[model samples]
Target chain A: MEKWRATSNLRRSLKSILNRQLSSVSEFRYLNEKRSCQSSFNLIRDCKSLGQVNAIQHRCFSSASTLVQRNPSFSTLNSDDISYFKGLLGEKSVIQDEDRLETVNTDWMHKYKGSSKLLLLPRSTEEVAQILRYCNSRCLAVVPQGGNTGLVGGSVPVFDEVIVNVSSMKNIISFDKVSGILVCEAGCILENLISFLDNQGFIMPLDLGAKGSCQIGGNVSTNAGGLRLVRYGSLHENVLGLEAVLANGDVLDMLGTLRKDNTGYDLKHLFIGSEGSLGIVTKVSILTPPKLSSVNIAFLACNDYSSCQKLLMEAKRKLGEILSAFEFLDTEAMNLVLHQFDGVRNPLPASMHNFYILIETTGSDESYNRYLY
Target chain B: MEKWRATSNLRRSLKSILNRQLSSVSEFRYLNEKRSCQSSFNLIRDCKSLGQVNAIQHRCFSSASTLVQRNPSFSTLNSDDISYFKGLLGEKSVIQDEDRLETVNTDWMHKYKGSSKLLLLPRSTEEVAQILRYCNSRCLAVVPQGGNTGLVGGSVPVFDEVIVNVSSMKNIISFDKVSGILVCEAGCILENLISFLDNQGFIMPLDLGAKGSCQIGGNVSTNAGGLRLVRYGSLHENVLGLEAVLANGDVLDMLGTLRKDNTGYDLKHLFIGSEGSLGIVTKVSILTPPKLSSVNIAFLACNDYSSCQKLLMEAKRKLGEILSAFEFLDTEAMNLVLHQFDGVRNPLPASMHNFYILIETTGSDESYNRYLY
Candidate 1:
């Protein structure tokens, strides 16, 4: 019963961490204000129970007020800037409410936090250009944010830099069935794009754990590599072209659909993986590969790393072109997954091996792949 | 006999253009001097036969002296620079022989030519750093050449910039079979690496017509995209890490083997497609995919573009993961290929279709794939 209670408390703490409830932030702020003289580290040290300590630590780390100071080079937000943003994007798009600003100010990992007074939600490339232009002229540094699912502290601001969210600009411009070329607004969520492509009998060149929240713009900006990269490759190869707005608000359109165009210096590559320092990517044109018919997955136990290595080599030689994914995990990782998820049982005996390998093969010939297995 | 004479004349002209024999440059120079007053346009008009016109046109275009003048900012090469290069890299490594310099001075396309007085071959990264450090101090511009197979005149010098060839630095540093990561010197030829990976039961993520001559460094610099990109993706996705020597001689070692490292900004990407403008890439660590066993190819005829589009959709839906390549060609392309290559016959009846589609599928199971087909 005591262990159950501890697990329940831990679940609640994890839930709070994952889902940013509006009440939790205010409750945390009120509790922090009441004990203004005591530091969060001291409070963590004083906690009697492990569950209570975990919850408190989670809350303390997530709030922006308890985080480090903002960079001084950037100017603080003023009423004029807020008014200008409202005039441009409307009052609803100009977010200033403290309750809603908490999530935007914090990152997915709760590692980086910013104290921005305003967030401008742009609905179009033109709007993004105008906002960036104003910010550049006013010496107001701005952070271009998408789904805020970046592992690095790239999506959040380091100082009083204005946050320009592109989520409202989600739109699918066009798709050529023959070429498997997709042109869409950058703010479109990756999962939505995947679903859309699935319906069209195609698949995106990349897939990741954060697909549900990560936007296509963020993926291109960071040059994200994911699970399917071992098979489909990276965005640089899949993305044929893109349209970006430079820092000075000049729109650079290199959005070409042709596969083999060697006209001039490939300037589109400069914007890719630049992380928004050079410009804000507003639209993307990407090539999607056709989905195959058969998929075979095998979960195997490996006695040692050498055996895993040998198995991978054998799989490569025998499987040839059908091998899609080859992923491995150590015993410690397996144990952690098993412990965290109640439904996930280990496939092999607990003491049988130290490594687990998961191999996936996809091809047009279902029977051939099955026979090989 | 007359047809044979015409063909032989055309071949000689083509050879002069493609081969870049030591005498071709001097012959082209002499021809240009003889026709100093006659414009190439006029010469083409004045020709008596098509074969004569072709040869004259080839000569007119291939002569570097007849082209635009070099950039004036770069200083002219002196005896001191040649001596310094010879001292750094032994006498054999420093090439000043006119006959040997012809191929190095001319590009693969034979479109651009450089009047470089000296070529320095560096065998190691340390030697590259030392050469660049001296060049920077002397205010002498430098061009880093690898395979000299670039299409954008990147590998060749624009003027008197010293050529630092890295072909001597072709060394396979290491390969981790477990992770399928191969590390090698930048100067390693792409085809050679492919063969090495083939022996290990793996395949490089990229393939191109220039693979036989293009170095891995050049491929990374140009971000070369080729035929297999539809299946394997691009270099940006496959390259995990690299080592680069900056303009000021700073050796930036970012060669990491781990799949995931999000500690800071991905600075290595800045060099992936920078075309050697940012720095000289000395080494690369890339992820190679495992080779599959079963392979199937089908040549289908399409009545129209719409039918080809529908067929592609169907192929993607049915093939799923095993679909490796889906290529299309028009009747004109088919006819050209058929006319150019002997023993190349059309897959379909001549009167049947306007378009041809080639689909290739690879998987682990041979019988399953064959049964599906």
Candidate 2:
């Protein structure tokens, strides 16, 4: 226990020292803006300090700036950066309203609060890339915001960083009916994408409860795993290719639709679930799934957990790959669901078992039903 | 275009020089056992040669390897290192059968060739960790191999390094029937797991075409995607917890059945699809599903790509989430399956359209099937 405590302390201390050193460097760069370009690269080059170096060596680590950067508190960006952004966006996109900023700073969870002085809303990937390039050159930190529906404080500023809101960039660039691939802007809402695909008779392979407000960009950032994970899968599987602007503003155009591309290391994955710490994803290309005609949902009450297991095995054997959902509603979860939701009823009596599985099976016709019956 | 060409040429030159330096260092390490404890981590630290330095710089410049580890050839370990590994294993389960090694090296596509000088098969996760610690201290690169049915060359050694074959480590540790979480060794075959679950009346939520030969470790290391990914999802989604040994021999024990864990960076994913460059996974905890009773399979021929896509969308609207498999088979893939496999008939006429779809609808009994059909 003593050794473990020491190890934890050492790790934290090292992290603090590294953050201090980084913040000092950032401050130095900000003060001497002329050398900011050269200094930013140096900081990236020395990132090993943040990841590897032990903290026990440095005693005065409390003053170190965290990896998350902040703009001067209570101060907005200079007219130069704002005008530069406005010049690229041609005016209507950037949001400077404090009320809107407050809303954007606090996400759906209401957990994280940001201090970003200004928020730039870009309408296109090119504009986004340009903005990032400008920010990188000036050694400015950026917070990439999507639908503002994130849970883990991602998509919101951790510090007083500039928020590059991609909400205005929502547009379905292209759709390949054959491959079921959808190419769209990063800010495209999940709900909109699903509806559009539904209208066209296709469906995005993945869905979640947050689909109503969550942006595809935010989803990709957290590699969002929701209920359909039992069926359609997570964002990592659905997202095919991404167009992201790196920290250095280099546009990584990994927009290929080929399922098998082993040209090099998969860079896109690093940004996925990175929470915009590494880069700003501007556009996304994802593999959508074909739609189904119907579904059959059964809320089953099992005698025991073993019975539930048996039930799944039987379904798999009889159903093959058609079983879409096999959700276990623990007794506690079931009680909570009943307590929280209106019009939702428990299918099984409380005294039956400790677990109740909500089994939902989907298919086109009566063949599946025959086996179940 | 000129700038791009120039950059590409510089990259190519840098790559060749780095490759040569690594090759020579590996050769030197092989000749002298004392130098065998080298890892990719050391390559970044002790690189004084221009070639080695340039390679490291190239990695830094790319923003590619910065997110992930650069690919390391398997020639870092020596024969003495293998002996040391044997000492760590206590000599009981190690296997060096050339025929077995040769078969295991070749993947499903026959693309990877394993040429390891030694093959150590550990029977338990503890043994695996011990061997890794010993090897890591000696700077030895250990290639982790299982039922090597990978589409990519992730399971095979890149050079003449020691191979830690996990075949002997197969065993079921524990299972929670209530939570539907199962813990097993990395070497457990997917089919065996399915069978075990079947006997118990539950099913592994995930399934793949390579279930017969592919081990869970291989599936995890490759983040394997399969047919059921359209439903139960890829290995990454189904995977709940893992026991992995890092490069430096530290064991990260994240074995649990918690649906929600916000502890820290999801370390499991870092090793998943890392191709054994980062660590070797020894055990896995996964969420299985309760069995379902039935499914409906449909083989449909569409007029065109758009029509096929439209058909899927219509089905999803009609079926909701019950549509499990909407496999879009390219004409080429369909023809290949039909020609190569017996009992696999073409669902559509070859000359009629550009593509064919095998859509399966899964659900409960006949009553539900009637509604779907």
Candidate 3:
């Protein structure tokens, strides 16, 4: 009975939160306001249980000034419940106060700087699921945030959505070194994952320049493409499985590391690049590559774009499967590189060409050198 | 008038092919006797005058016989068209015989074997477009065949569809060695493209086992994923732009090598893995990578999965950014390899561990020895 009473109180607060959020959506604002007003009629009918109902109402509408003068059954909050929740989760981890809220509100792109609101830092998936279930029942919008380095405006919230930052929920759940698969929290940074894999004599199959700040969750959301796509591929190939919380607060436990499993509709692919419009990814399983025996790199200079094309054809024939990276550089991009990097000069002479390319090839077979010779 | 008569005669032969193929389908077997009676009516209608009205009737009957009969409209193809597209770049390339038809019918999987009464090999994009326009107007179901290495039943015809094999369309249209971009014909073999680039000290950005047999068009159609995807990525990343013929026989000129273009919705992505359902990709513009100086390969045996994970973490932490392929091999797969390949021996001792990993790394910087140490 105590748990039921507490849940009912939570539901009332949640409904109020939903009403506030819906009131801002232009079309539904007036409808929700009318619905809130009509709740007084229901309160009048429940007057026999008025004492319990009034206590719940008081916890929600703490200030009389925020409420309208309505039916005799309607009651107002005295002033303690709001303060109690404002202090919840403060002991478990650092909660974002007004000062820290400013930075978390905006994404890397200044395009979407959401109005800073409550930042709930969850330490475990269960806590997140619980919070989501509570928020969901009350019609609250929950936004999951990570390293927040997305080019697309997906990591940031749009309205009065509750921000559930999973940065605190960091843990390496399991890793099968034989299969080269790692299961970790979504908040895990790509740099940390790479570093961890490197120690195991393996490396994350894919890489990018934003590796230092980009979280794996954000990477999975945008299906982020990077430099190593010339070799290791995009996130679509690297990510084996995921665990996500859907919009309705249903947990999707799709954690599988098998290479080939055609059980049914591939639900994982649908959520991968969904940008959180579909669900919030809590955990991830990724396939990593083992360390290589030997590697080689080369910077090639070409007379023209046609020369680069000719070079690729010849190199693939000679290099066979050993060809790894074949990155191209236009004259403008090469010039930019030369100017930006200290002591870095163009490999080609000024009279020679209009474009440049950086090529690297690696192989476990020694015969790769014989072809190079 | 002669061309129109030739089309009318072709339509008669096509109707017979459709009827024959329909009999082979298990679902349509019930409709077999009913379809046979209509063939005689098709023969008389197919022999009508070379007028536009008769051509329309010819198409209606042709589509009615095949599965998913999509009737071609008059606006798609005019009866007065008389244009001949010869060779590409002065190379006379055309083959129209039973022997050649049999050769291009079967793909690598041998699942999608085509039985085209007449096969037309077009040498260039212009020729292909012209052929499609002419056939499309007569309501002909045309199947576009490349190296025929497709896994799905995409490159082959299910019925009496005109088979347009782009085998003779092999030609290097443009090559920019500096930019590492190559524009080539659809029928160009992957191996030949690699060889052409290799001779000039460059290489194909991607590689696979069936390099010699697979065509660039086949690669683009299926969005091919291969071993090199552990590094270079799929055809979707490498291919910058494509030229294709839409279902309505309209040529979509989308050949450009720009990396970043936010002009509109990405239309090229739709055609990449559509398996030639939407359009026929005629020309391709791809970004190629530069050649590497050298490569290093290493094989490792891990005692346990956790130690393997630790080893990868250590290597990545110690190696910094210069790391590449780290392929994990289970003992089951390793034993299979040894059993399958005659005289093949395990790189590591059998008593040491349950799994082996092959690692390779490549870099252009001259100080490669320091990374190894």
Candidate 4:
């Protein structure tokens, strides 16, 4: 009875945590306020004139409390530069299309916008290398973009720099069923990789809300720690190795698919979470876990914050491997969710609780999972 | 009943794997031969002449097929250098004692030995920085020594380099129980940290045969992937951050306990497995998993290596989180363990199995673990 009560409290905390996370689609994560931190991408898209776009960008940057000025040192993109890129990447890959550039120039949140004039899509690593080489010698600043789904202003160029997108390089290089290792090109979408692994009776070690559009390269570059981090750990744990390209066009082939990292100086980790600053991750090798058979979820409530913390600790220690995720949200966030979305009802309407938690457990046996739940 | 039979197969394989690991203490891991690949450390200890030492070193290098010659540019330790170190550190920290040098010069395997002239024990990171800074200016190469328990020849000096041991700097800086993060100095013994975490109701992410003698610094330096790697992960995964000192006396404070790694360039990983070439790790911030309540072990047998691999994949996927470890050994290794150890008796005496396997599972409920087993 005591264990059951503790578990109930744990479930409540999870719901609360999850609620907070959902509301965190705004700029900051886990903001305590009940209000939805809305994304301004729609607002940016609604703007008509170029002057209006600048006004919106200026206002958003000002509201964010950080203003970045464009460096005067960077070279402007010229016809000669375009010719070199077009010759190397072919005419079709050299994207001067205004519509595409406008879309790619803005961030996912629509808060940050860049004034980049040209976008280059490279199908092969060799082509990406040549593009970077030419850009480097000419002192042309480049933004190594992957999917352009980044919430941060990292992917988009701040000025008239050229954008290098690796979306065309998307390819599943290899997959080892026994080891559950997947080696893929930088541009592979997270959703595609997830689907491919699902077919193989394995799952990617990570799953996030942005899986639909986020590229595997962007995920690696940011070292994405998603919902499954509690179960599978971060990219640091799952990623075996990766290949990256330097500004000088040096392809650092640190990609090794070994589970055991006994090799000297794990250089790939330097690229992971670097957000393409150190180098642009070209290819990735990651270790995926096998997909389990059954999953069970529960929603419960806790009295206080301390109880929530205790419940999580108990779940981590006691539940061990079966505990996949434990998320919680405070009363305000839960109330906001109930009020904001129509047709959505509260799971626990019995009483006004301080916190709500959701606990999810997974196992191989369906019957066992249910019984355990 | 079919599940029981499969589990039975898993246990036998575990026994076989454990057998193979037991013999691996000598040298090469998973060597299928019945004969022991003995360590020559005791033999080196008995050597009376420097000529014999040279012959042993030469033979070992030649047999390994990798000969590393000493660089002539590195200056030998002199009295002035000794005086400088003594002034920088206290008199007792600076050691020219031949007896002490002999012990720190050889690895745990005794397969590799170094001829280091001086052993300097620094009490703090600052002292370590100064020592390196002086050594850098003088072009006096130095070997950073930890617990001196490394199986590979990474801990010892190749030639007459200065030995910088961090034994005196052992300290548990801080531990956050909520996060299960331990921040400790480089020289703290692995076993000691394990004990500390065990008292706090948590466990280290890794465990190995050399835990008693190995230092956490050396483990991080080599990126130690130990027995619990199947359950947890490597140091690359568990070690959240670290503090390192470069040869030019530049102290890089990358030590952070935050589980979220959104920061730029995880530079600590570069030092993790660089074997002290890039820099020497001074402090570590590692995430430790919570200690579970129940543990179950099974010894089973299988016919072939392919079956063992299949069983492991099933255990990893199906059993999921509860499956802590899956180890196996071939018949030859089993025979060797039984033949070598007098008191050791085979649990599966009924039949001569081709492969033996061991499966371990842990959970919160004792009843649940037994039921699952």
- Quote each prediction's TM-score: 0.74, 0.66, 0.52, 0.81
Which is better, 2 or 4, measured by TM-score? 4
For every candidate, what is the interface RMSD in angstroms? 23.7, 15.2, 19.1, 21.1
Q: List lDDT for all candidates, in order.
A: 0.69, 0.63, 0.59, 0.72
Residue B161 CA error for candidate 1 (Å)?
Answer: 4.2
Please list the residue runs of candidate 3 whose C-alpha ends up more than 4 Å from where it truly belongs after superposition: A1-103, A108-112, A116-144, A150-154, A158-173, A205-213, A223-373, B1-113, B118-142, B149-154, B205-213, B223-237, B240-274, B291-373
The sequence of per-residue lDDT tens digits that candidate 2 reaches over residues B1-373 is 3433332333233233223223333332132233324453233222222222233447446532123322343235556765776677766655567886676556567754546656788887777778766765655656677887776555665445567788887899988775578999999999999999987767776678889988988778777766666556566557877877655555667664555342222445545665554457889998776655566777888767888877876765565445667788777777787789999866555565667778776554545644665
The C-alpha local distance difference test score for the whole of candidate 1 amounts to 0.69
Best by lDDT: 4
Task: Give the alpha carbon lDDT tens digit for every residue of B209-242 in model 3.
Answer: 8788888987887777666554555565577778
Best by DockQ: 4
User: How close is each model in CA RMSD to the real structure?
Assistant: 16.3, 12.0, 17.0, 14.9
* lDDT score, candidate 3: 0.59
Looking at candidate 4 chain A, the ten consecutive residues that score lowest on lDDT are: A39-48
Q: Please give the distance, in angstroms, between residue A266's alpha carbon in candidate 2 and its true position after superposition.
A: 4.8
Q: State the displacement of the C-alpha of residue A38, model 1, in Å, after optimal TM-score superposition.
A: 38
Candidate 3, residues A1-373, lDDT tens digits: the string is 3433332333333233223322221121122233332222122112212222233357465632123222332233222322332444554453447766776777787755655366778777676776666554544455678888876455665444567788876788998766678999988888999899888877776678889988888788667777665456556556778887654455666667865332222345545765554457889998876666557778878877778887866666455444567788887888787889999976566665677778776554344343463
Clashes of 2: 35
Error of 3 at B136 (Å): 7.4
How well is each residue in B300-336 modelled by candidate 4, as lDDT tens digits?
8998888888988877876687888888889999989
DockQ of predicted model 1: 0.18
Query: Scoring each candidate complex against the real one, what DockQ results?
Result: 0.18, 0.11, 0.03, 0.26
Chain A of candidate 4 compared with the true chain A, TM-score: 0.82
- In order of lDDT, best first, we have 4, 1, 2, 3
